[model samples]
Target chain A: MKTLRVPEATVTRLSIYSRFLERLDRNGITTVSSGEIAEGVGVSPAQVRKDLAYFGEFGTRGVGYNVKDLLKYTLKILGLDQEWALAIVGAGNLGFALCTYRGFNVRGFHIVGVFDNDPTRIGKRIGDLVVQPLTLFPEIAQKENIRIGVIAVPTSAAQEVADMMVKNGVEAVLNFAPVAINVPDEIEMRNVDLSVKLEILTFNLGFRNAQSL
Target chain B: MKTLRVPEATVTRLSIYSRFLERLDRNGITTVSSGEIAEGVGVSPAQVRKDLAYFGEFGTRGVGYNVKDLLKYTLKILGLDQEWALAIVGAGNLGFALCTYRGFNVRGFHIVGVFDNDPTRIGKRIGDLVVQPLTLFPEIAQKENIRIGVIAVPTSAAQEVADMMVKNGVEAVLNFAPVAINVPDEIEMRNVDLSVKLEILTFNLGFRNAQSL
Candidate 1:
């Protein structure tokens, strides 16, 4: 049978849904209805059903979703079933922090190598990984099976680093740089611009303040 | 007349619109058609017009919006017409990174005080301001007129810190902690979770991999 395609929004929310389910699992919830999961994750029950329909039928009409079975399905659907090796570029403050981040390591993702253009930081150790120079990205990726490249470099050098990572056969990249980057259609890119986030909050507060006047 | 209410989604996009407008302003573009601004911000012209209508009609039906007028109105609507003082809790790696962050200062939001429970970090100078203990939040907020709080504490301490900030009279909060937080209905809370972003990327890769199999 041909695999059913899921919307990117649905897949995005699947990660969100999985997080809520993990909380439920910890609270000893062995079963959950669509309404219950929807409320937990702040989505509509109909939307949840529609999103999960593409994967398979995991729910009964009245009994709702089985917690462990649904979690296994979510894990498989999100590729969390297999561990992903991460190559973090730029061993600066942000890069070093990400390498030592317990959150990424806890989520079936491991930072196996830290890459940088800085000579001083290249030989340093962050946790168990010895930092390597940017020149070794392709070599290290080929040998160690590193598929994701994280660009935490400064804005000016971010594009160049992204280009090199794509050239090295990285399929996906998570960019923390403040600038937008251009990557191939086949290469998936996600940008986390801290500045953009602050601007959003500023606007929110601004709107509320204006309303009070 | 009753004040017009803008949708939350439109408020979010207004920040993006303002950023693009700033680029135009820098380039000496004094006026812009709605289509021009929409194209620059990667939104449809109709959507832009619709969003702007939520506040008040600003654009000419044919000629478009006057760039300066639109920019000023958006800024006023977002409450960036004047400066806002902000307090950041937890002067750790993330907090330190945020304090030195050039974006907040540029956007009319000021990080006037940094707070932490650690004695070693408190009283340390980060830029022009000295770090203070969590106990100083109320006094600092009152003295400095800080209206917003940025919470970067660990998950274990997030709720306690947030509760303190709220009691100290912080009406708006931007939480960087990965866990979900409970706030009073009157307080506006926004959570920025980096792990959720990576998980979204994982799901994208998963669907693509599954399709190829």
Candidate 2:
């Protein structure tokens, strides 16, 4: 089991692997080799083994991996073994969507609170949580023991919101703002740039078009 | 120039290369060898060459590649050179956020229109475009020449929304819905799951914890 040295790319792929494994389990897959998992998730089996090996040898040399055990191991590696209380920073449409976002509650993560600077949105309810003022983030985060922060604010205000989250001792951040935020090396950030994916797809289409010509 | 079919993994890495090249260019880097680009992007120089070779002979035998030229070629290969019109379905939280989503507009892809089933939301304004009923999708999409469809609707309605987009003649789809979609092989689909990212981070953390013990 390696410590905190897992590459960010590896972490990202592990997330993909987790989803694929869940799909496998649902299909009643009782066991899987790294190669099978790789094919299913679109990765090299060696890469899969290397990623899993960062934690330990979950798969036997000749036999394969027990599906349920591997799932548990992946869950543990992702820090999803226990419930993580989440706080959404922006209470706008994206933030509101995230507050009730079905994704969080699915994998041992929960939105415990919502915060916004706007007074109109404050006291509004999304899901079971009521929106609170941004001024109360420090207090509420501490009270709820929130470890992760979701910043869905505008680009102009993203850095300010990120700084606030860092100062309040939040370690992991999921940023949806268009711009990238510079954080200390210790703070883990996974930026969900809705546009980057499209840009990549755009590039893909462009290449395909060029090849056709 | 040899067009060796590069792996999907390699194509994904091109974006990273493009980003690094931009950084190098910004730093006044005019020329770089394959080794340099590989080192900067944390890949093998041979890999860099191989990936670039897929599109065309981007590098000279002696000199590496012109930073700007290589970037432009990669961008073209990725299809970022052309503008894409986007039609979004479901004017809910995700839809509204995407309409105001700064990422898409900055990248040459524009959200020309947003459609929803809710009559109250129809005819309302979001950004520069007016919200229209989902019924108008075929008409508007045809009129606007929308080639890309973005389905930001909830999981329950995602399939129906996708079917409508397909019927409207959108060839590529970016689904933000939680469910897996079934589409014809000719149509390209990419799903963005925010929770999967968190799950990967959790998996890494879990693996580290196990190794330490």
Candidate 3:
């Protein structure tokens, strides 16, 4: 095995490319060039090639690449080839949204549990799973072999929930608290800043307005 | 005014830098070096300087940057100087979450309208505003002078909703539908892939496991 330090940006692009390839595959397109992939995903062709180069060569010099094979490779690299059991904490509106979000299911992530500390929310049903109290996290985590935990709680409770998740043997965390949370060095963690993309749109709109002046 | 073609990545970094600076401003921090900002935001020092250089020189050679002034500059560059009125389509759980999301309000984005086609959802209250019917979108958009629209509908309705938003005179859109949506060239549009970051974490976790084998 080789020790590879791939840039996080490359991983993000791989995810995007996988989705683009899925579209092409569904559309019955058999082959695609780097240029086509780049155009489909709104990225530069050179950037497409550069990001892919971090992993291994996928496309030919001029004959392009098979869409299905590329898609499979991307998904495999992203660890979507295996079924992942996930637990979403903080069963508020955001947590409920996460539970029903189709994107995770499509990517082979199964939400095994949804937990909350509030007594009223504990017995509530979100999808097929009943919300359990936070105290049951360790028991449910062990019973279900949950590896990934999502923190959808408020800013104040995010770090505490993350700490609890780590203590219960979760390997990775996806935090949606809008605030940064600290985790152990060994844990894989990422913050999903939902508002950042909105800010980007506003920035561009503002830029266009500034240009018109 | 300059017709500058700033990269989308630069806009994203600007948003992150702005948020980090906001935290610093709230903490009463006066000055920050590029290295400090980079450390705080998890970016490289040179990358921080380069991002700021795109707007203009903000820091002295060695004196670093004034936190408040840089915060204001980044916000202005990102169009946060003026309040942005937003309309969220699809008053489901996701839309309801967006309506009350503090992240948007903190960044000067006001959710002036929430719309849905469902009868049950139409008469419901998200916060201070009641959910309106889809037919009322045009009227409310015009009355509230909505400049940005959020499509929180499912993937099946994302494109159609985006088209409607474009027709309703929206200048920008933030899509949470998990599908790629097409908008007119004149409208600023961005897709929020909430599951991509989770996949990235899974990828890294898989990579680390593979390395240790």
Best by TM-score: 3
Instruction: For residues B21-98, write the lDDT of model 3, one tens digit per residue.
Output: 999999999999999999998889999998888888788878999999999999999889989999999988898888
Worst 10 residues of 1 chain A by lDDT: A1-10
Model 3 complex DockQ against the native: 0.73
Report lDDT (CA) for all predictions: 0.81, 0.80, 0.89
Better of 1 and 3 by TM-score: 3
The clash count for each model shown is 2, 16, 0
Task: Give a tens-digit lDDT track for model 2, residues B26-104.
Answer: 9999999999988776679888887777776677779879999998877666666777889999888878888887666
After the best TM-score superposition of candidate 1, give how far the Cα of residue A4 lies from its true spot, in angstroms: 7.9
- lDDT string for model 1 (A1-213, tens) is 137656567877888788888888988999999999998877799999988988777789999999988987897788888888888998876787677666678667888789998898889987888889889888999887887889988889999999998998888899988766888989888877665566566666665665688
Against the true structure, whose DockQ is highest? Answer: 3
| Model 3 C-alpha lDDT per residue in residues A1-213, reported as the tens digit of each score | 236688788889899999999999999999999999999999899999988887787888888989989889888899999888999998888998988988766777998999999999999998798999999999999999899999989999999999999999999999999888899999999888878888888888888888888
**Over the stretch A128-202, how does candidate 2's per-residue lDDT look in tens digits?**
889899999999989998888889888899999999998998878888885558778667777676766775567
What ordering of candidates by DockQ runs from best to worst?
3, 1, 2
